[model samples]
Target: MIDIKNVNKFYGQGDSSFHVLHDINLSISEGEFVSIMGQSGSGKSTLINIIGFLDDEFKGEYFYYNHPIHEYTRTQFSKLRNQNVGFVFQNFKLINTLTVADNVGLPLLYAGEKRKAIKEQVKDVLEAVGLPDASEKKPTNLSGGQQQRVSIARAIVTNPQFLIADEPTGALDSKTSREIMTLFKELNQKNKTTIIMVTHDEKVALQSERIIQILDGRILSDKKVNA
Candidate 1:
């Protein structure tokens, strides 16, 4: 579903140049659940941003589906990202003022969807993430796990083909982290949503089907987990 080849990212030009990624080549298949692991300053997040199309100022080719990504206009890029990709950040990016339902339905609002349809889709996703009763509540009222679930629901409500989670469980406790991982597994199995997550936790990484470890702006290892 996504292919990145010979991608290199530099932070600045000339004397300030700091390479964040080095000829990184990666391909994520449809319905694949992949985890990325790396230490501090290892360029994992940089690569994630590149793959997510948030950092377009990189060096190399990124092909989404079949078309070259850079060829798309800003409006077209926005639409494709909205339609195909969803993101969950380390810090839950939910608006403090909006209700959970409102936050989850935000993406659909941008798509110009009908309110009734948006409500239905939001409710379904909330239920899928095991937060049916919390939709009317605000993010501040929910626990860490619930907030992350809200973030997840918000990401998947549009039925996006890909979900990119960066340190999704960084703020949660062990039990909550496990619950979120279980929820992710169920989503992957049931809906076939392609998932790519970046994490520093070993147990969390193990939940994924495959893990790729990065270091010094390059891939160090890639391995499949035992079922």
Candidate 2:
């Protein structure tokens, strides 16, 4: 569902320009689970940003389901991002002030969904993420793993075409990380949810169906993980 060709990214200008990505050519099919692995400053984040439609200041041809995302207008780009991609971050980016239901419903709210529908969708996602009773509780009261679950709940509430998970298990302990990975696998296999995750941990990356390793500003290797 995603195709990127000859993509390049740079920062600054002229003599001081810093290249962050180099001729990145990649394609991810619908419902595939892929992981990106790289060290700090290796440009993995930049590549995913381009894939997720969060960055457009690069030279590339990005085709999403045959649509030229690289050529979209800013408004169209924003709309595409809102409607197709869901994001889960290492920090769980939840609002401590809002109830779990409120947090999970933010995307739908922004999409102008009605209150009744948003509530039902939120409930369904929370249940899917194993947080069925967490709707009324504040995020601050939850454990780190639980908070991450809430974040996952929020991300999937929209039934987005795919998920962009950036270091989703970075903040958790080994056991918690395993649990989260299990949840991600279930989502991928059962719901047929596509996942593109960026993680430094080899164990984490190995859990996905395919792993792409980046070195410096280029792809070093792309291989399928052994089952």
Candidate 3:
């Protein structure tokens, strides 16, 4: 469902250049759960951002569901991003002022959905994330794991074809991280959504059907494993 070819990302200018990603070539099929593992400065997050259309300024080619992603205009990419990609960051990235439901509903609202539809969607998503009763509460009131669950709900509420999680369990305890991984497995198994996760933990990396080990901004190995 996604392909990235010869992608190179460089920051700064001229001799002051710092390369974040180098000649990345990868393809993720539909219904595949792939994990990206690397140490700090291995460019894992840079690859994620490029894949999710969050950063398209780098040199290379990107195709989404067989269409050339670079061909789309910025406005078109914004719409496609909201519709096709769901991002769950390590920080949870919840709105400080909004209730859990409000934060989860933000995507649909930005997509121009009606208020009633947004509310219903938020409720359904919250329930799916096992937080049916917590929607009305503020994120600050929730624990770290709970906040991460809220982030997951917000990501999956739109039923995106691709779920991009960057160190999804980075902030959670072991038990909660396992729970979230289980949730991700369930989503991939039952719904057939494609999952691309970046994690450094060995256990978390094992949760994926495939592992792509990156080193020095290059693919060291890509292998399939049992989830």
Candidate 4:
């Protein structure tokens, strides 16, 4: 569903510039669960941003579902992302002030969905994430795991075709992380959601069907995992 080639990303200009990603090439198929593993500053997050259409300052080619993503305008990217992508960050990016349902429905609201439809979608996603009773609660009132579940619920509420998770388990305990991974597995297996996750944890990466390791801004390895 995604293809990239010779991608290079840099910060700053001319002499003061620092390269963040270099000559990256990859292709991910539909219904595949892939993990990007790298140390801090190894360009894992940068790659994710590029894939999710969040970064457009780099030099390279990107094609999503045969659409040339590299040439999309800001508005085009926004529309495409809203329609096809969902994101989960290491830090639960939920608004502390919004109720769980509101947080989960933000994307649909921004897309101009009607109130009744948004509410139904939010309710379904909450139940899917095992958070049926969390709709009226603020994020601050939830535990770490519950908060992350809310984040996941928000990401999947739109039924996006692709899910991008960057260190999604970074903030939770091992048990909680395992629970989150189980949820991810169910999403991939049952929902056929294409998942591309960036994680430094090998154990977390192993849960994916494929692992891509990055080092010094380059892809070090890409291999399928044995079940």
Which run of 10 residues does model 1 get worst, by summed lDDT?
70-79
lDDT tens digits by residue: candidate 1, 145-208:
8999999999998889899999999989999999999988888999898999999999999999
Q: What ranges in model 4 sit over 4 Å off?
A: none
Q: What is the lDDT of residue 129 in candidate 4?
A: 98
lDDT of 3 by residue, 48-121 (tens): 99899888688888988778886778888789889988999999999979999999988888888987868888
* Order by lDDT, highest first: 2, 4, 3, 1
The alpha-carbon deviation from the true structure for residue 109 of candidate 1, after best TM-score superposition, in angstroms, is 0.8
- List residue ranges in candidate 1 displaced over 4 A: none
Model 2: lDDT of residue 112: 79
User: Against the true structure, whose TM-score is highest?
Assistant: 4
All candidates' lDDT scores? Answer: 0.90, 0.94, 0.91, 0.93
State how far residue 90 of model 1 sits from its true place (Å).
Answer: 1.4
**Model 3 residue 45 distance off true place after TM-score fit, in angstroms:** 0.2
Q: Residue 169 lDDT in model 2?
A: 100
What residue pairs are clashing in model 4? none
For each candidate in turn, the TM-score is: 0.97, 0.97, 0.97, 0.98
Question: How many steric overlaps are in each model, in order?
Answer: 0, 0, 0, 0
Write candidate 4's Cα lDDT for 1-227 as tens digits: 89998999999999999999999999999999999998999998999999998887889899898888898889988887788899999999999989999999998987879878788789989999999999999999999999999999988988898999999999999999999999999999999999999999999999999999999899999999999
